[model samples]
Target: MHKEQEKVTDKNRFKSCMMKPDEEGNIYCPQGHAFTLEQRKESVKGRYPRTIQFYRNEHCEGCPLRSQCTRSKHGRTLQRTDKLAEMQIEIRENLMTETGQELMKQRSI
Candidate 1:
């Protein structure tokens, strides 16, 4: 019982140490091997379907590190998490809006 408790504690600590905080106070760990935000956006934009599929199928298939990265059988596919993607979309939309353009100008100053 004591050993089991110790193992659990260690696991929690390890997880905590591996986490990185984003600007929005969310935690993520860009470790192991995965696509970057640019890559994910490109995939969504249909700019890199074949490349994405290759990673989703050939590279990630049957790898021992899958558990640490992705739960999908095709390997760890990177889709934008809701908040992250939404933020990007919002920013893009804002840039098109008059108010957003003003804000961008101010940011440049």
Candidate 2:
């Protein structure tokens, strides 16, 4: 694989093991560190305007996995945009299916 692809795969592998927000919008890490919504902003321009929410957990300060998690001095922050996240989720679901796999193979060729 290319270097960029390997880097993305490595990041994804770690992200799969990290915390994800629940349906109610609550996010807690594996160690039970609660994340708070830090900021919300609307995109100025895109195919469609989107509202993004940024969440961070202050508890990541002295965690052993800090280096593996993030390089930020403050803490780890997760950002999600309304329409983009939903669209990406849909695309990810489609990419997991047989048809999508075939399409990807054709594209690769």
Count of backbone clashes for each model? 0, 0
Tell me the TM-score of each prediction against the true structure: 0.30, 0.68
What is candidate 1's lDDT per residue for 1-109, written digit by digit as tens? 1232354342353243333336763444333333323343323445433222112223556556446555666444333345554565576777789997798889889
Question: How many clashes in candidate 1?
Answer: 0
* lDDT per residue (tens digit) for residues 3-57 in model 2: 2234444355336334556889788765577889899998778576778888887
What lDDT would each prediction earn against the true structure? Answer: 0.45, 0.73
Which residue pairs come into collision in candidate 2?
Answer: none
Report residue 15 deviation for candidate 1 (angstroms): 26
**Residue pair clashes in candidate 1:** none
Error of 1 at 100 (Å): 0.8
> What TM-score number comes out for model 1?
0.30
